[model samples]
Target chain A: MRLINHIPGRPAALLLAALPFIMIFVAYSIASDIRLTANPQDKLLPAPTTIVETAERLFTVPDKRSKEILLWNDTFASLARLLGGVTISAMLSLALGLAIGLLPYARSLFSGFIAVLSMVPPLALLPILFIVFGLGEVSKVVLIVIGITPFMTRDLAQRVMEIPKEQIVKAQTLGASSWVIALRVALPQILPRLISNVRLSLGSAWLFLIAAEAVASNVGLGYRIFLVRRYLAMDVILTYVIWITVLAFVIDWLLKSLSRRAFPWMEANL
Target chain B: MSFVSVTNVWQRYGNRSILERVNVAVDEAEFISIVGASGCGKSTFLRMLLAEERPHKGDISIEGGETAVEPNRERGVVFQKYSVFPHLTVRENLIAAESFDKPFGRLRGTARKQAEQRADTMLERIGLNHVAQQYPASLSGGMQQRLAIGQAMTAKPRILLLDEPFGALDPGTRLQMHDFLLELRDETNMTVFMVTHDLDEAFKLGDRVLVFDKPRWDPQDPGLFGATITYDFDARNKGMPFQDILDQYPSLSLG
Candidate 1:
């Protein structure tokens, strides 16, 4: 048990240890494909060297129009809206879930309503939101909130409810009041699950954001992809897709890192 | 006057009688242990004392002015399964009693500091000061049970109730905890009422032992379940050893 405590960073260490093997596999596949496709005069398909060069040029060079498009204000606009929507959803879900989950009467009253609400897909409600709020930030933000909150609320509430009754009873036996039991005891016990749910909802929110932005929007990466699709500019579409994937990856990584830092005890258990 | 009194208490569960016509009294600072077979209402009696359950046919009164037990800070309870919250550190568990400001009378500034200081002193007394910062999950079972004891005692309650606090531990740890509890009771002189199944434990720590027997049902009195107190013996006998007492009550032997 003493030695177990010293073996920190196991997950990160395992991932680090596996990275070289993954890189080797990818390199072997690329090398084999390059050797097999010996036709040097293939004009339609860019060589791996050219693709790498294009990627390097896009990242390193400052003046290219394609590079400018990649680093445009539209990207920031989309990111800002994504951040706003996710923040609102996270806060509202946690507050509402805690209220309903911890209070028995509230749970009885709202549980059915939340259950029914969760089954309705947000995409199906897109038309209704567009009609109510119209084509602007309001509808997009509302769509993301509506899309994410129910799932997060349900997940968080269930997690909160599943905390061992002994923990709460123990606190009560110590003379802790209802509020203290909820805030101090119950909340901390379910925090790991809460954070994991938030991470899950972040991804869901991003997926909803793209679908939300695809309709009635002149800006954002989604709109950019929609516009480039008409001209058959697969490169731009693929580039934005890659950018979105990378952005989501970074956000997910940051959230996980925050969870690890905030809860060293959870890290130890894991 | 008795420090704690239960008068003609009859507790029934739905259709079954758990404790029937039971009465007991404890003087101030007295250590009383109740031992009974499984499902023989020993735990039910403890619950009644803690006010977690109500009696069907009679009344229970604390000598302190309160007529009914109503979540008072004056009574502290330690459970069998070790009810310490896993999220809280040992010190936090001790100070948890401070969070109930209504019972403690508006803890603020100097009062809160004093309470915390007293908790630290209790940590030292329980020999858990080294694990003050450790959560209950990280502590060993014996350590966790000791922490539970410290947490329960931190409120400085007038009476301490132990519902088989050491019942879940192995024999060696159980004996160690029993000794620790005995030493603690000697130092504090706090009134204790422990409900246990271990007769030896009852003999070792209790100033007086109350033995409860299984209920007997009679056809003539169909509604009345007959339960009786088999014995109430002085645990502080000087001339007779505990083994001699066990010899007389052969049923009370551990084997």
Candidate 2:
């Protein structure tokens, strides 16, 4: 007897997708229960109820010292730094990348240098950035920018290079100047690719952001997590980690939806 | 003096020559077809006229003006592939074609309305009104070619340069496109210069045909020289009536 392997339908697929998470939850819950039973105070893995209570308190209650909701403050600070760094990096890369991709002189002058610069690890320069920029928000935001700008610029430049030569020639024949071709013919095509590139680079951006904040910051997600770690605050750390993962996932989904709605002609892979 | 003139034009890439000392003149509203082997200089000559590339020697001028330097709205071109912008819908493509010369600030209000009207008329004439919102990728090969041609015609250029516009079409569709092109030409009275490999296509659509080849080819030294217009036949009278001229120039090879 032969058994055929067929693709699962929607409901089966959803159940299959949820299976791994359920297993992980059950395993963690059982471990937590055993540890708590062995000793009523287990800091390594707290019970699920402790985590829920911590979440409710952290979300609703305000800090007695600062008079501000800690979670919201942390979220707002981190998001502002991230948005500021990424927006500036994106705009700069678009202009620089187009010049590098379209103009021979610009490509020859900076392409090799940019390639070499991309090789140097961004984390290695964190100490220097902290030294020069000091322990302010500037260093944190600058770290995020420095971490992802070269990669994003290179990606956008490569995307621009991949545009068909015929389109450039056609645009020229259509009375578009070099600048016009750069803006109208090439920029529109690469915008969706840029968004996809930004989506891919978000992980690295977050890594740098957290590292910078953890090293030195009064407020932010990473600062709060690192601060509470001295007291073995596992529940707070777990809640924050899960919250960060959800936030990242939602941002990715929003960018993808934006790309689809704005530039419907882009291939579906983007 | 003709409307378009190619005088002592020669093209070289480093040491290798592509076209050497070529010369031709074409009047207004003339449909000239160029035929040759794949590596021949017919397409290169067309490129020179379009000002995509400048000849190493001599010049190509239109309407007694300065030597052509770069491609502009005065010369419209349709390539064998990617003839239409994939990002744009058919109607937008046509509208953009007419609005190309206008300043960015002036592309709104009355100018935009007029451009849309022109695009609608062109779409109706080309029988693409139903798929006006469709992108070039979704259209069939023949339909894309029609849209490409229609897109080029919308610019109202003085000369339309086609680089094998029908080379990618099937036999039936190619024939239909030929009729469509002839009708379009008659209606608009636009000058056309086409490069193709099919001799029958050249004969069918052209008022004159130019053949590019090397007249003197040495087996060992084939790289020393380049191809030139070895034969220019007047195809004004249809049905292969240039037999007498072919007989007179016995060295001419039809293929």
Candidate 3:
């Protein structure tokens, strides 16, 4: 009866979850109908059928000049750069985070530097990066790395610091050296956090990736979306945007499941 | 000769003195139980012995060796919680104890098989064989503490330190842990120092129960002085009465 006491059942919960998405669809359909009625050639909001058809064509049809499916090519190029940047960031952050979290000397040296680096808006460095690394794949990948590394590193460092003092002392008494402690003790525990951090940063990585592509990339989902905007190809742009959202969601879900499978002990704690 | 010795040990944290002029001596295979009210420096003294933190003054040495600057394989320790590695399964936690001494913190070939056998033996001894593959999070409080003690013993250290190792357990589990600790002590002549706030637990398992209290305290600044060993009862002797100890130190809580 009371709102606080009445927890929704499974079906109710499902419907509640779907309600917002359904409402968004209804709103978009009505708005599109009204605009199309006023002007048959309106490009602001495409009909649902138009978007689907555009997506199908994008997926199946090869470009006339390149003889490649533009959509698949763009997806592959973006994925390659994203994975490259993320892998490098994860490896570097793990090492730097462990050092900053465990060693006093490393903490003093990097903690302040990382704090300042994280404070500097990563997007603002876009121009400098483009100039230094040039308008090639390197610049785009570097933008993603520069965008997400500091936050991920700081998050991992905090998680490492949260490890109980007793565990560290227990490891020492077990005759584990500093290196052993990092590899055996700290590394196993922080891995779940690293995966979660990677998941958290994927959004920002995509943001940086898209910005780079829109600005300078010849082949990417962002480049395609930005290139068709001149003719107000709303159907193509909408398809690409939906595809990007799905990709980001899949990545986050995959990382979550991987962490759960890898670190069963972290089930309740995480 | 004493197997473990502490002479004129003092500890401080900035302006607050936690321990001062603490002295004790224990023979090999003796179990030393420490008891006092909270903030009386019992845990600090145990930390000093574990070499987790050094005393501000004086020294503590074991087997006539030089004072340990940091924790080493020569000594083992168990805390009330966070003693067992949560990430490792019950069996791996025990094997990890011995394997940590290896160069790579691991074992292979025959050494690996032997470590696994020893770990299995420890698991049986600790009565945790049923959950050998389970992580520490899934284990009960008593079982976790048993696993912790078992892990500590896997190294066969000369001395074992327990800092309120059973303080977090329920009353029933705590009693079981007492029996478990005594059985392990019977198997080996490992000098043990355990700090607990429970006076009854102190007398039940300890060979000599050492009570920490402040002999000198200023009325204006109560912490002007620090705590030291006020009573060391010979618990191994059945003739020693605890009723009299209770009357003497009413401040200590009896668990």
Candidate 4:
């Protein structure tokens, strides 16, 4: 079989995507068996059975203290923060991006500033964010916002700039005011791009969210993973990590499909 | 008196001169076609009329307005590409053109119905009623251009500026568009200022054909001055032979 570019049928394509995952599972199972044979209580390599049990317990059973399914709670909290930060950033990016792109004065004022802002490593400001925003949900959400907003704004601003000058000029000739041109002509065109940008920025958004939760929060998938690390709870950690991966994949897929369906005209070149 | 007048207009980009002292007086409902060599300021002069750019010296007055400002509904333009909004369906594009100045681009019940009715009529006129619900991307080049022209005309602009509107179409499609434009102009009595590289197109559709070129070559200050109306021919006068006009401006006559 060729290593690349072979057009596989549906089942084969699914299998091809699942290949690496299956390999990892088998390899880990074999290593776990070996370690368990040597020392049955080894925490480093948990068996598949151990991971499955942990997943079931985490998903179904309630936390002893809070009487809530910790897994679902973590999922909800993380998703809310992620979506909140991303939604705010998307709106801000659209506004500032349109302004910076369409107006010469705004471009001159903000383009360089935004470029420099994006260059500052967001993680480096984590401690300052914690101190300033008080390590609450505000700081966590703000971290994700600050972490992704500048990059998104820059991306969207560049996208706005790339909007053919003809479109803007044509909008003007159609008796559209500047407001109408920005909100109507430019906004609809950039929304699909915004989705694409958010999809690309999802990785960093997850990173900042997890880092924030791991450092300060008592709730979240990240906090749970970090909390269990001292006990060397590899089974729970591995399950949580896989769940997070699944969630990220689902979010990205949903966004991509939404963009494709809602804005079919966007993929003209594709 | 001229309905559209350009007096002593000059255009410069950095040190390069594109247009200089261009004067033209266009009566109401007059179809004017502008032709010139590549980089000879035909499009630049058209841009001035569209109010996309201002002349560094002098002014262009449309319908007695003394100074050209940003493009408005009074002047409609069709570019070679992207004249239609790709995101909107054909009907929506026409409606948008009609409703852009309305509050929030909304037309109330009867107004909305009336707008849709007008859009449908225009769709039928352009023979695009079959694809009224489709997006511009799905349409062929000729169909899309027709939609764009219909969209621009739905707003009823006093003048239409076409920047090589058929430059990208096939020869057959170009001829078809030529007839469509002539019919539309005759029906609406719309004044048109078209810029094209096709001399035949300029002569075929224009009531008055203008050629912009550098009349005097200055070896010392080559870029100091710009193109001007070097030749003006009355296309409505069929007695004035094509070869005679071509003989007057040898640089402008080509395939």
Q: How well is each residue in A81-178 modelled by candidate 3, as lDDT tens digits?
A: 99999999999899999999899899999999999999999889999998999999999998888889999999999988999999999999999998
lDDT of 2 by residue, A1-270 (tens): 335767789999999999999999999999999999999988999999999999999999999998889999999999899888888788878988999989989999989988998888999999999999999999998888888889999989998888888788777777877777787778988999889888988899889999999999999999999999999999999999988898889989999899999887765646
* Most accurate candidate by lDDT: 3
* Candidate 2, superposed: residue stretches over 4 Å from native: A1-5, A267-269, B242-255
lDDT of 4 by residue, A1-270 (tens): 777966889999999999999999899999999999999889999999989999999999998998999999999999999999989888888889999988899999999999999899999999999899897888888888899899889888888888888788888888888788887788888889899889999999999999999999988999999999999999999999999999999999999889889997766542
Query: What are the clashing pairs of model 3?
Result: none
Native-to-model Cα distance after best TM-score fit, residue A96 in candidate 1, in Å? 3.1
Give lDDT: candidate 1, residue B188. 86
Recovery fraction of native interface contacts for candidate 2: 0.54
Q: On residues B1-255, what C-alpha lDDT tens digit does candidate 3 reach at each position? A: 688999899999988899999989899999999999899999999998999899899989997888889999988999989998889999999999999878878999999999999899888999999999999999899999999999999988889999999989999999999998998889887899999988888888998999999999899988779999999998865527574665678778565
Q: What's the TM-score of chain B for every model shown?
A: 0.85, 0.91, 0.92, 0.92
Q: Residue-wise lDDT of candidate 2 within B49-168, one digit each (tens)?
A: 888898999978888887778888888999898888888889988886876555551268888998889999999999899999988778988899888889888877889999998988
The CA lDDT of each predicted structure is: 0.76, 0.88, 0.91, 0.89
Best by DockQ: 3
How accurately is candidate 3 docked according to DockQ?
0.69
lDDT, model 2, position A9: 93
Candidate 4 regions with alpha-carbon error over 4 angstroms: A1-11, A267-270, B237-255
CAPRI quality band, candidate 1: acceptable
- Which pairs of residues have clashing backbones in candidate 4? none
Q: Provide the lowest-lDDT 10-residue window in model 3 chain B.
A: B237-246
